[model samples]
Target: MRTPASQRALLVKISENVCYTELVYQRVNKKLSVDWSHSETEAWVQAILRDPDSLVEQRGKNYYVANQRRKSQLTVNSHNYRLITVNRLSK
Candidate 1:
């Protein structure tokens, strides 16, 4: 099992190369209650991945990046690094 630090490092390293499909983009924004454009939403997700306090976990084929401060979790494909979606954590 990869440690949290290693998972975080690997995820951040691939952040710049990740892909965001239009379908997932719309899905993410709807789930997260955000109206950001494609670029803005991608940047927001990347920021969460790079945040020092964020926790990363791998389950099945997906990487879950969760940030307490942001109150959201971002899901990305482990193999292709394609952003799957994001969800806001309930307060």
Candidate 2:
């Protein structure tokens, strides 16, 4: 089993990007007052990255449960999320 510290680090690393398909978006936002846009999703996942303890559930690679209702069932592939450390330079 992974240590608590190691697991926290892994959560931070994987939360770099929270990937989801259109179907996920539609289903998730169907009852919500606001639409779950990409930017919103990114921000929500980033918040979780900042605080892994906030996660209500971590069920393998397919799902994560955050405190926020809209972000609970998000499909985040930590391995697939690209790590962009630097800001883009303007041409």
The TM-score that candidate 1 achieves is: 0.87
Model 2 scores worst on lDDT over the 10 consecutive residues at 82-91
lDDT of each: 0.82, 0.49
Instruction: Choose the strongest candidate by TM-score.
Output: 1
RMSD vs true structure, all candidates: 1.7, 10.8
Off by over 4 Å in 1: 1-4
Encode model 1's per-residue lDDT on 1-91: one tens digit a residue: 6787787777676576688899998998788777889889878877887788888788899888888899998888989988888888875
Give TM-scores for every candidate, taking all chains together and pairing residue i with residue i: 0.87, 0.51
The residue pairs found clashing in candidate 2 are none
Alpha-carbon deviation at 49 in model 2, angstroms:
3.0
Q: Positional deviation of 24 in candidate 1, in angstroms? A: 1.3
Per-residue lDDT over 28-51 for candidate 2, one digit per residue giving the tens place of the 0 to 100 score: 456344476867746755675666
